[model samples]
Target: MSAIPVTIGRRAALSLDSTPVPAGSPLVDTHGRVHRDLRISLTDRCSLRCTYCMPEQGNEWLAKTSILTLDEIELIARVAAADGITTFRLTGGEPLLRTDIVEIVRRLAAIEGPDGRPVEIAMTTNGIRLPEVLPGLAAAGLGRLNISIDTLRRDRFHELTRRDRLEDVLEGIAAAAASGLRPLKLNAVAMRDVNDDELVDLVEFAIAHDAQMRFIEQMPLDAGHTWDRSRMVTQDEILGALAQRWELTPVPGRGGAPAARWTLDGGPHTVGVIASVTAPFCGDCDRLRLTADGQLRNCLFSTTEYDLLPILRGTSGEWEQDIDGMLRACVRGKLPGHAINDPSFLQPARGMNAIGG
Candidate 1:
């Protein structure tokens, strides 16, 4: 509420001036993968320079000219809505960093749903700037939020994230709970020796606030290619640790949730673990991600991407139809699962931030 956070950008780029994809182009692609859920990155700039994603003060941010405008995002959402996507989420280097984020929420929320209701809207934030946007966003059609808070320790938090906002995020979590953001989930990327010890502490932290916590397996999503299996906190170790610390039991939840559901001994809140590495859920993968720059990534683990901006800007708008055709082409290689741990595997060139992580 003090003031909006500064969105990272040198200046407005020409990339935001592109035309929208036309209608009747069949937004649906081959594998029957209708545009069910769309993850839109507001910007590819994050405040936290995590060891996995960004090196300490050593990274290149995307130029302002290369990012999409709110209008561009609205147009894309509308077209994707026409195709079939009913759910939408705002992501970013940190979506909250984008000062115009609240307006973006309102714009995307205005997108008409299949049943004529506003689209189901949500955001994935780092919680640093959530306090500022929480009120405006909730009023704009945001249904829920997923905040990334990897560690509970203030010192370790600074060490891992290279940011100075542990208490700030904690306050945001409290504010989020009071704001009626039901099913608020804390996303924790489990890393051995970094924050793995906080797994139980995180669950306890969430329970006290009546919030759910999800421990996600660290995958190869960073830029430096520093992902190591030895450093990974596997699903087995997570469950084993929980079993030792608490009387854990399985709890039922959504089908497509990346987390393997579980509950504490006798707590009011639920804690989940997203076994992306030890247990990949590509079989039920029913989502798609569209980058802010107009590239379509069919699978997060796949390096292949289809550039859609060129097609969208062509004179006849024939690119509209090509968007559909391109999607169909992507299905041919939707990759049932990711081989991130394989020694022969190579991570996608783009960092997690670039890919709407």
Candidate 2:
């Protein structure tokens, strides 16, 4: 990909000078899930207040000053890539809400991958604001996109998002696909009595538009801490629903990826479902999240996080040593499952935005 003179205000480019990982430490987790993917949270700021993810009373966001600087985030990504992470994702409280995202993507593309190739950079957005920034992002080395579209009905979209712009979102998807973004991924959360009936239609839309649709099982996260199991729609139910129209079959894989792959009978296109709640994929979970506040989370449901910014701002040698040490230290403490399914479990202190969901 060619470099573009992309500029985003409020942040600056970071230089990567960290040495390669020592011989002993490997990036793969116990479940054979290598640290090939890194999701970095730029800020805990978003434009919408969804009921499932955001509180009705609104969330207490981290102060802007406390969030990781762009350079600091880039340093972490460099270290992470050394440990085998190549597929990097920029997330948010809506990453687009950040003041310097385009520049951030440009800087990330400069971070070399394990094999000296430019890493595959992507983002997950709500897509309402995508049209305005799609060209900038594509030119800045972003190759893939996953947009969250929970409902097709305008009123229902507002109910799910607590905002309006279904039209904007659709247009953004159209623009992204038309821009050669390649088989755009649509993220739809399957909520009982909410968008369940829209599953068939969602599949139709994906097929018609030549996009891959992924239905996510609503998990107990964010404002959904008090999750209504009655409101939950399991992957089994989703499969049953989709099976009505097409003869769905499994697409086997190494299983490190979260979504279980499936193809429609006699069709080339495929769809996926993330059974995070009913069928937890924690055992094979390979991903890790870096919060804007500089905490390294081993698991989404894991309560404790090891902070790394202080070391980064410290002496360069010690910072590199400490970051490498922290990466090694995090491996032993990683959790097999988030354990969010436990009714009595108190969620870790961070909100979805804080953790960069």
Candidate 3:
């Protein structure tokens, strides 16, 4: 919890200004991609500076006052649930960095989706703090987890994440399995000449722990804006390497799912690959993003952002309807895909952490 390097910016735009709106029909975009998943950033501060995620120093941080409050977070979830967003994932620079995350989970877990089912709440964490917060999170109804762990070697772990917390992360993963966090998974970003050599080892670790593993293609979300396609480890190469050691087969019915899963032959273990760069899945993407500062991103690589704070904080009788209209307009504006392969592509203004991981 010690302070790290950060530059403060205007935060009145980031407050937990509530954005609750009147319940509307299921949110479907112009491309007919219905909004069913919502990724909400709880905070823009993290405990580590992963080389691929953020710079080692001089990164800007949102003032705590500008971060959304627990109430504000819950209200957004409730409104999204009404729009049929049943699967909600709480991400962040590190979601655990938020002091009231447990309460936030408790409130979000209570929301009912349009289908009459309670919203399914999950979290993506760095795992260092899971040992301390896992129990509270589980009790508060967290359905599952995706832990970010890129390396198995302690030295490499520190080198990659800029923190000596690999052991803590491993412990957190173990504790999560023990605590009954079903469908627990590990997220690893596959970068050429970096951690690709350890892909098999990472998958083995997941199999041994009775958890799923997913390797994500490196995208242009780094704070330094240095990502290039040549440096990316594609799904074909990843599968080729893993196939040499294990028998893997694709699992069917992976529509719109970010991860294309495969089962280890004769075993109950599975692994996934999110090839955002080489094998884009934008057509089936059923998700939206809400930054910790209250910016709504229609796509992970969206060039446009809708500021929902003013409408959220507005005091007007028709504000709810107006909020509903805004939601529809934003959804309607969703991009068909993130053109990473296109030479004309440009990265978003915010990094992955600022965009909620």
lDDT of each: 0.74, 0.76, 0.83
lDDT of 1 by residue, 1-357 (tens): 112122211122111123343333333434444447778887888878877877777677787866877765665676566556678888877889988888988888887854576788888888877777799989987888888888888899899888888888888888888888778988998998899888888888887777888888888888888788889998889888888877777876556666777767776657788887778876666677888787877778888887766655545433334554544455445665677657778888888888886
TM-score of 2: 0.89
Q: Please report the TM-score between candidate 3 and the true structure.
A: 0.92
Error of 2 at 205 (Å): 1.4
Q: Write the per-residue lDDT of candidate 3 for residues 57-142, one digit (tens) a residue.
A: 99889876667777666766766777778888999999998889899889899888656789899899988899998989999989
Candidate 1 has its poorest 10 consecutive residues by lDDT at 8-17
The residue pairs in collision within model 3 are 14-66
Q: Which ten residues in a row have the lowest lDDT in candidate 2?
A: 1-10
Clashes of each: 1, 0, 1
Q: Any idea what lDDT model 2 has?
A: 0.76
lDDT of 2 by residue, 113-151 (tens): 556888788888887778888899889988888888888
* Sort order, TM-score high to low: 3, 2, 1
Residue 43's lDDT within candidate 2 is 80
